[model samples]
Target: MSGIYIHIPFCKQACHYCDFHFSTSMAKKDAMIAALKQELVLRKDEFKGDTIATIYFGGGTPSVLTTTEINDLIATVYSNYKVIENPEITLEANPDDLSQGKILELSQSSINRLSIGVQSFFEEDLKMMNRAHSAKEAEQSIGEATKYFDNISIDLIYGIPGMSDARWRQNIQKALSFGIPHISSYALTVEPKTALATFIKKGLIKPLDDELAQIHFQTLYDVLTKAGFDCYEVSNFGKPEFYSKNNTAYWLGEKYMGIGPSAHSYDGKNRSWNIANNPKYLKAIGEGELPNTSELLSLTDKYNEYVMTGLRTIWGVSLDRIRSGFGEKYYVYITRQMEKYLEQELLVVTYGHLIATKKGKFLVDGIASDLFMINLG
Candidate 1:
């Protein structure tokens, strides 16, 4: 089954460390919604024979849209695409936008899962990240949301500028206190053009310590696993059935269509992304033109992508599939590259599958890059 992702490019404010595409203005909100519906209708033929298993509302905080608006978007998807019975419809929301009343309204709507952005429950961390919610609001929103929704996930950031190991542990424990079924955590990274990078360049904030981040990742894994959550993906922990269907479909290389500005779509062999500019995207859709660029993946590109995504999950890269799908040459190259990591116990071969050890999980991305097939024309 495939999925549909709708991107909402409006946020109340910008986060210091985020470089995602979003506008702080709501002047064109109505027009943008119309464009999104039109885009879905325009692309319906792309998934003519596929059944949609997940409809994900992702973005600059999808909660910024009213429940009516969200339902309208979902309705558009239903009318245009073939959706499965009881599909997983996820809304990425922020604490500030999820008041008690809002939570109740959303629970009554067609949305079944919520991915709340509660970066941290500390006042200092919230202020540092310029999150729109306070510590109290973060806890309060989660508390209220749980009363109405069982499939919920919260985001947490580790290795923040001043976050100590003890504080990181507390953050995990606090999340556990809420009886949440899923948690998506990541180490803070300084994107080149974001305020976090600027602060470090000017000595206003200390540079990120990779070693500290590694330690924090281990702590996260240990705590969550002990609490009965599976580290199904590198940064995602869930209780068996609560894993994110939308993200899992993408990671597994299933076909998906992304609607709205700055969204991305993948159709197994080709990938495409819409324009990141809000005004330009709106104008193009208004003119009945798709403002996106696409590329057909080379054999090397497909193999490399499989390696990159496969290593980050509990499902490791398959040796037999690699040989049969790509060819024997790729299998040989990857097996040769796997020697050093295998010797170091960073990567292990289990039942013919190449999997990362716990020691290597935090470093999987770098390891995956090292194994990339390059210049194999």
Candidate 2:
């Protein structure tokens, strides 16, 4: 089974640290929606033999669209693609857009899951991030949404420049207070060209502390695991049945089609992405063209990606699968690389899977990179 991801490339306002493609203006929303539906129609054959197991509405802010508009897109998917019965349909929303009325409307629609962007429950943090919602709105939105949807996820950011350990603990406690089943949290990283990076460079904001972020991640894992949430992936914590199927599929290397500007798609061996510019994407789709670029994956490309994604999750690299699937040389290289980490207790092989140890969880990315199949043809 595969999935389809629809990128809603419009937001009411830009967040300080975000570099995702989106327009603050709603000027072309109607046309964009039409182009999205058209793109789905144009690409349906790509998934002709695969059943769509999840339909994810990710975004700049999917909640900005009306319920009718969202349903129309779903209807288009249903009409064009082979979707599973009771597929996981997720809508990524912002707290400000999830008012009581909007929540009720969405609950009654085909959308079964809601991933709300509640970056923080602190006023100062919200102000620094330029999130459009207040602390109260973040709390209130989740409270209202819980009344309607049980499969809900909220985003939380940690390691804000001035966020203390006590404050980060408070954020976790506050989220648990709402009985949210799933939480996706990440450290605040200053991406190049984002406002956060500029502010740091200008000395208007403190640069991110990697050491602090690691502390926050450990705190997050400990607290959530104690609360009976699974650290299925480094950044995602979910209860038994609440793991995000869409994201899990991606991590597992399943095929998925991404629709809209700057969205990406991957088949078993090839990957593609749409043009990032909105006007160009719309015009190309209107003119019966797929404005995208593609690349066929080399064996090394596939191996490196698998190692990178695998080590970041509870499902570690399968040494047997690696040896069998990627060949003896790759298996040997990885096992040789594994010796040092295993000695440090940063990684371990249990039941034939190479999993990251608790101490190494925060450092998995760097470790995975070190184990990458670089300079190998």
Tell me the TM-score of each prediction against the true structure: 0.99, 0.99
- Candidate 1: the clashing residue pairs are none
* Model 1 lDDT per residue over 186-255, tens place: 9999999998899899998888999999999999999999999999889999999999999999888999
| Candidate closest to the true structure, highest lDDT | 2
Q: For all the candidates, what are their Cα RMSDs to the real structure?
A: 0.7, 0.6
* Model 2 pairs whose backbones collide: none
Report the poorest 10 consecutive residues by lDDT, candidate 2: 368-377
lDDT of each: 0.95, 0.95
